[model samples]
Target chain A: MKEHKKLPSAVIKRMPRYYRYLTTLQQMGISRISSRDLGNRMGVTASQVRHDFFSFGASGLQGYGYDVDLLRQEIRDIFGLDDLFSVIIIGAGNLGHALAKYSGFEKNGYKIAAIFDVKPEIIGERINDIEIIHLDKLQEYVQDNHVDIAALTVPEIRVLEVAKLVTDNGIKALWNFSPIELLASDDIVVENIQMIDSLMVLGYNLRTAEAKLNPN
Target chain B: MKEHKKLPSAVIKRMPRYYRYLTTLQQMGISRISSRDLGNRMGVTASQVRHDFFSFGASGLQGYGYDVDLLRQEIRDIFGLDDLFSVIIIGAGNLGHALAKYSGFEKNGYKIAAIFDVKPEIIGERINDIEIIHLDKLQEYVQDNHVDIAALTVPEIRVLEVAKLVTDNGIKALWNFSPIELLASDDIVVENIQMIDSLMVLGYNLRTAEAKLNPN
Candidate 1:
């Protein structure tokens, strides 16, 4: 992989959505798609979709538009999806259990290696054949395995501590599910999955819709 | 609530992040903050922060900058965070159970009224005093209660059917946690929380960083 200028954060955030939609189109046996149709499906303007693809250096044939399979494969390569990314969950709680059993991540190149927890009752258990190990063993496990991502599903209070442990032990990326934001240094990439934030946005949009309907 | 012109979806998406960071500032007893400092904390440029605030019609004092509490409250209001939003989860699976137990959503005005599941084994169980009801009763329950949001944590295969049932009974907004994207008509608002998308972004970012480091 050769180094290129870093893409803007907004553009990086949208790449996965494009990848997902392109894959959907491919699955439907749609071999080609115009930006207009793709934008319609994604709720964005055709120009917006074109601008996004521009960031990826991807273009369409003037008349035929994009080749769905080739476009999806190119985006997949940009995401480094061809490489298997071994992941470990740092909590064995409900969310952790669900993520371990989620087949979607596995399909997208993230393989669940194991789940780690501090709870004695959960330490010896397994979810979807991924064994749960005590938190104390996480550092050693990372040292021995090619762990690429650590899904931090631990509580907020313990996030900084757990994050420090994971990053210190060679895990360079985090899928943080904690309520509090985790501060990452230059070397680490942290994607904060704030569930409450998503719900709040839904609340705001729903209220806005009601205001439009009732005008009160 | 009066209807103003609709804001851009990109600006709407950034509101929760602003709200979360402002709340964190308020909690720390920080009285004032400049756009630059806020940008430093949020990993964006000062100009970007100012642009975002400009969208909200919020301006900082020439020298003193933004009053932390006031800015936070204003953003909170923009998000309609003061209103109580009753929500129901469509699945009583592990993710649904976890969301029902997450107190963060309750703190932000989204209340979990009940969880709906077709599985008899989970139907009677409760998480954080929110009972799981049979899926057959969801429509009736929505009619009787003021349900504003449906947290769709069901499997991807069942999403469309479940979404239709809830929306037909008056669920206008969805906090979807399913892997597949949900298609929403004009009357419905769907916030698709694709967990796998987040992970893939992290993987892409991590690989990009590695490419920068090794240049191979």
Candidate 2:
């Protein structure tokens, strides 16, 4: 990144949104997109989009707007998507299996290096051609293979224990699917996603909208 | 609630975290917790926790702090979690099947009404006892059954088409897993989970943290 200042977490979070939308535009063969049009599609104001772009030193011509391909490339680079990361899924349950088969991560610079599970039945199994190895081999594999991230889809009770194993083995980040909230050191980053929390947000919003529609 | 003003989106987003933590505390048999302790567990400041509670008209005692059960109940009520939302998965893909089998939703207000897909092969299949029905039956099922949310795990190309079908059928909220963003009307809420975006965030953070640890 040319910009010396560290971007805020919120801004960093929105970078992938821009990357996704811009990639779509690029695929559709749209050569250019104005801040206004991009913001409209992204559900943000034009000035907000311009300001966000400025944070990453992405500039647009006064009348012409941003070049679609260049802008997408810039955002992708900003996200460190240019670098490939070897990822390991820590659990071989349904969620883990689904994530293992998800092709989106490979498309966006994440390569599934291995999958670890305690279950002997699934340990040697393969999901979408990615082998599920025993958890005993996790630390050794991570150390030897230089795994970048551990995506934990283990049950809530096993989160802390499994997290310790991954973090101890030099995993710099965690995409946690378990409901348990993890405490990370300054060098380690944890993105704890409680899927139910998201569902609750949806439920709450749905209720409010329902109320507005029929206030009985 | 009692506060006539609608809660801000940021506050609404935090409600689930609060609910989750409090529920954990409640399960641990911890009946009372001060804002400071709660904040410590939640990675926020005591004052910030207090402020968030106040946003929903939840007040902590001067010294005794908040009642864990009471606080959890209040947040649950705020999230409108007392009621159940009938949910349907739009695609019968791996992710969709995983979500269908995920028991967390039923434990927290979201009940899987059914799973829908265009594929004829999987139409009669079942995931966690929920039937996978034809996508053509979605509109009629939703209309007659009153589905509160549609969890879209469809392919990128089919997202817009499937989203329109659900939204038009009065599905109030969408938990979209597809990479493509959905445009929702004012009355409908869309929680777009770009899983790749989250993975990118983890990658970016990892790179930055790695740089800090071993600077070149």
Candidate 3:
């Protein structure tokens, strides 16, 4: 995050892969690893791993892959995941309920400090021991819990209102699952994940890949 | 797909952006656009558009950016969105139901043809008018529906077993939202999307970015 060109999005995208592979190595009690071995686990060529690492800088020893603990710590620093992140979910619908209980967040270093819902039925209800609070308390909860980022799984039509709420509540970044694109300022970084659109991308790639492999 | 060197996975990732832009233009009834204009809408440098298009041996007219209709259709061909891609959702959970009703799928040329679940209460129930069939019927339903892609939003404990079923049903592609990785072959494509991991990525990036800008 120094005064320099931003980390390439592609490089940032690879952080999860690096984290996953590092986690595996740590589990095996391996302290050091070579780029080739890391590449083997990641399905990328070793040279490619080295290239990506070189692009982002790494703590790996030359010809030695990486020091397990140092590499893990270094990658965490690079990803900025070393610190705890406070997250607030902006919807308490069925999707939100599943997301609240989804253990994936805990493993990847995201702490769900609060869940927001406008539904009278869901408000005050607890899922996975996390209480669903009324949306009216969003700003207070966000400030109280030091929430830096939030994710919205609200209906498409209601996204703008919730987005405004997130901004007013001091949220810096947002992961929006609603299909509609919410307008936000340059200060507000928003990532829209239209799931169906994602499926189309993968589906199209799958077909294109299949056709290339089996030309008629 | 016609004898092109495998496009970088990164390229595959960005096709959706291009697709979205094109769709937006189509919806607006815009007939033509230039590279600069397209680049502006896509949030990429103009040169990037030219370079990315050239990678596919495709480009818009020199003076005019691209013919709206031609480019739209060509992008589809590039991404293979023209083909029918039948999708199966494993886990008839709330999230799965919301995904089934997600309008972006059919809007963008992918179809959710089947929903599989283990819960007896939900089995045979209708979701978005799509039947929530039993898990016991998965393989047969997949074959019957000619489904070739599967999305796993199941419980983490059941992920591996359900993933095995999906691949055994001859699905060439699988999307894993569970925290567990779904094992696959070089021939089969599996994209694992851990929800919480995405939140962490957002948090980490935001903090790193903020720290770099405000050296406190």
Candidate 4:
């Protein structure tokens, strides 16, 4: 892979969306797609699509458009999706169970290696054949396995301590679902799934759309 | 509330983050905050914070900075959170159950009015005191009640059909958790919670951070 300069955060955020659209096209057996068509599907202008692709060094043929498979592969490489990532869930609550039972992540090379919780009743149970271990075993498990990501589904009160334990054990990335914001070291990557925030945004948009129609 | 111009999409997206941070500060009894301090907490520049607030006509005092409660209330009003929104879950699976059990949405005024499922076994069950109704009853339920949002947690195969049912019943907003993107009408709002996309971004960031450290 070429050593490309770091793309802007906006472009980085859109890469996964592009990858998803391209995957859909690939699955449909469409080998090529015009920028205009792809952009329409993605709710963006053709020039915006072209600019995003250009940032990543992908150029379409003048008349024939871009190769679906090639563009998907390039995005896959950029996201390092070709490699398998071992993920451990830090809480065995409903959200944790949902993540463990979700088959999408495993299909995309993100394997749920283990799940840990402080509750004794749920510990030792299995979700998708992966046993839920006690929180006490987290450090030992991280040391024994090559874990790439720690998905923090713990409660807000316990999330900070759990994050510290994970980072202390050399985990470099955190996919936090906890309501609180985590302050992690610069080297560690934290991706917070603020579901409430998303809901609030949807609410705002719905209100905006309604106001436009009523205008009262 | 005074009428304001439609904020930029980028600013609209960041509103929830600002709300979250301000909520935290309010809980901490921090009545006033400088743009620099708020910006640091949100991982943005002070000017960026100022710009977003300015877009919404929220101007901070030159010497005293912003009032935490006032800014949060402004954002809440902008998001229309003062009014309770009736929400229904479209699937009774693990993801749906998680959404139904989540107390955050209700705390923020998005009530899970009911949950619907096609399956016979799980249809009548309760999650967080909200009864799961049969999917066949969805149309009747929507007609009887004013539901603002339908949280789609059904499988990808069933999502489109369920979405069609929800929209056909006049629900204007969809909080979609299914992997597939739902194409809604121009006036309807669709917020997709693509967990896989988020995981991929985390993976990419992890890879980039590791590459910076090890350059191989």
Candidate 5:
């Protein structure tokens, strides 16, 4: 893989969105797209889209727009999506099961290698062909398998412990779904899915919109 | 509710984190917190914390710090959490079922009034006491009940149609979980939970970190 220039955090955040749009365009049999059309679809200004692409050295021809496949491949490389990652779910609850069965991650190069649970009854149960193993075996599993990310879906009380267990065994990335935030060392990367926070933001927006309309 | 000064988008984004941390402090029986302490816990600078609070007219005493309960309540009011919102899930698949069974949203004042699905087999199914109704009944249900938000968990192919169905019936807020973006009118508030984007960001971070460590 070529070493790419470090992008601004704001630009890095939008890379995924650009990739998604480019993929959709590809699916619709679009071989190339002008910045104006792409920006229109993404709800951004054409100049803004050009600026973002230019920041990453992806430039369109003077008159002929960008080649969609090349731009998407560049984004895929930036996200390291070409590399497959082995993932383990730390809990087997409803959320965990949902994630295990979710094919999106697998399609995006992250595979759920196994699931761990403390419950004896469900220790051997299978979710979408992936076996649920005992939590006691997490250490052994990580040691044997090349695990890349540990998706923490344990209950709030057990989240910290499960995170510690995964990191202690050399897993460096954590995708946390529990409500609590995971404080990991500098070497570890943690991404939290704060569903309630998003919902709260939505609620706040709705309230403000209503207030604007009513004002009483 | 008192009228609040409009906050910067950055501050508004941090409000939920502050609320979560404050709730944790309250649970731990801490009635007051200095900006320094709060900032340290939230991984931000004390001045930044104070600036955010000051922007919202929440000031702490020079020596006594801020009252945690009062601060929390102010945030709650800002987020309009005091008002219970009627949320209907639009899909009854794994992710939908997980959201229905998850008790966090209910505890946070967003009630799942009902679940809607097109499948006849699971139409009358109950997830955590909330019945799954057919999608055909969505219009009548929204007409009768005060539906505040529609949680769209349907497949990508059906997202736009479902979004139109809800918004056409006067729903204003959408908490979208599908991978597609919903293009709604100016009046509608859409909050997208892009799980893949987050995972991709994490992957990019992990790759960059690995590159730094290897330096080959």
Candidate 6:
């Protein structure tokens, strides 16, 4: 119950994937999962699953494995997601709007607290209950709401500039959708999403699987 | 080069990461880089770099290292990105739009051939030269343009449905940004872009670094 205990970001990251898999099992009305079963979801070995789960002090039993609901709660607590994070949206572009009204945000203990955009065309528009504020109002919003994390869906050319604006306003983390890398001070963490690298992997994997099947 | 000559998928996956590191060196005007430098960028041992590079036919001088530009080109060619890939975007949501208009996509030989959306609201919208078309029109576009790969950025609830539509339309590979597990047939491959997992790893590394700095 310690207030400021930090989960290793890597552990925090895997928590979501694990959460996704567990959610699938939960949807199927499954009550228990061996670490191997969890690993099978991501094409990883069961030992790898046990090792990853060990980092969070929850390990599947040798015979009984893990109680799906209990493991999910333990992870939720470790990731500081037991309470919803007040997440603001920066850059009310298509990406920002989709994200602001995204279904997954609420599911993962995140609230789209505010939406910001510099464009006059979209400044006052609302996505769901959240209104789109001008980017000029970012500092005020961040300070007033004590915003801790933001989703940067801005133009790649301005990703760093906007990142500075977000971090300077006392934000500690960001879910960056910008293609370019955002260089941040050690205090603030930024995650870049690369689409092509992902696509290439899928293509290569498919090709590899086909090759394996037809080894002539 | 033979079109169907399949490289190891693991090699293909890591190529971009190594390429990014080399590109960093190129930006710094570092003409040559040692395998150790690549290893450091990847958080792997220098010997591991030597081992992987050997597989790639990087039989360079024992003392010196790889030419950064040359190695970069080789990596690009190995990943089959020396030429542009005809790519498409499925789901005109936040992640999809960000991907369609991403500069990194252009930089990496991925050209957005089309964008598909099921929502009637987005069907006529445009991201760069790519116009969003309804899912009903996807097969036409894929057959006409021969879009080699598709990126799935739909929500979890719609991920499987959209993936099925894309693959059914002849998209042999998919880059899934949705935070859900996809069941791909043997003929198609799906790779989930788990950004949270990567960020978690970064977070864990940061924690380890912090622990080393402030060991109690």
| Highest-DockQ candidate | 1
| Candidate 1 residue-wise lDDT, A1-216, digit = tens | 224467887888888998999888888999999999999999899999889888878898898999999989887777778787999999988999999988887778779999999988887887999999999998788778999999999887899899989988988998899998886678998899988778777777787877778775
What does candidate 1's lDDT look like per residue over B1-216, in tens digits?
223456777888888898889888888889899999999998899898888888878899888889988888887777777777788888988898888878798777677889889988877888899898998997688768888888898988998888888888878998888887887677798889988778877887898888778875
Q: Considering every candidate listed, which one attains the maximal TM-score?
A: 4
Instruction: List, residue by residue over A14-97, the lDDT tens digit for candidate 4.
Output: 888898898889889999999999989888999999999999999999999999999998887777777888899998888898
Candidate 2 regions with alpha-carbon error over 4 angstroms: A1-4, B1-4
Docking class of 2: medium
Candidate 1: CAPRI quality band: medium
lDDT of 5 by residue, A41-99 (tens): 98889999999999999999988999999999999888877788788888888878888
lDDT score of residue B134 within candidate 2: 98
Query: Per-residue CA lDDT of candidate 5, range B1-216, in tens?
Result: 356655776788879999999999999999999999999988889999999999999999999999999999999888878788889999998789889877689768789999999999988989999999999998899878999999998888899988989899999999999888776457999999999888888887777778888888
In model 4, which residue pairs have backbone atoms overlapping below 3 Å? none
Task: Give the per-residue lDDT digits (tens) of candidate 6, residues B86-165.
Answer: 77777776667766766676667768888888888878888887888888987777667767778777777887787777
**Each candidate structure's count of clashing pairs:** 0, 0, 6, 0, 0, 6
- TM-score, each model? 0.96, 0.92, 0.91, 0.96, 0.92, 0.84
* Candidate 2 vs 4: which has more lDDT: 4
Q: Over the full model, what C-alpha lDDT does candidate 3 score relative to the true structure?
A: 0.75
Cα lDDT tens digits for candidate 6, A1-216: 113355555456566778778777888999999987778777778887887788767777779999999887776565555456677878887778767666666666667788988889877788988999998988777767866567888887888888888777877777777766564455666666665567656655655665677776
Interface RMSD (Cα, Å) for model 1: 1.4
Which pairs of residues collide in candidate 2? none
Per-residue accuracy of model 3 over A129-178 as CA lDDT, tens digit each: 88889999876786577887778988878888888878877788989888
What DockQ would you assign to candidate 3? 0.51
Q: What is the docking quality class of candidate 3? A: medium
Model 1 residue A69 CA deviation (Å) reads 1.1
True contacts kept of each: 0.83, 0.77, 0.48, 0.78, 0.71, 0.45
The list of candidate 1 runs beyond 4 A from truth reads A1-5, B1-5
Name the weakest run of 10 consecutive residues (lDDT summed) in model 3 chain B.
B1-10
Please, what are the lDDT tens digits per residue for candidate 3 over residues B1-216? 233556676666776777778778989999898889988776788898888777767777878778878877776776656665677788888778877877777756678887888888888888788788888987677656787688887888888888777777778899878766665576777777656556656765686658766776
> Once model 5 is optimally superposed onto the true structure by TM-score, how far is the C-alpha of residue A92 displaced, in angstroms?
2.3
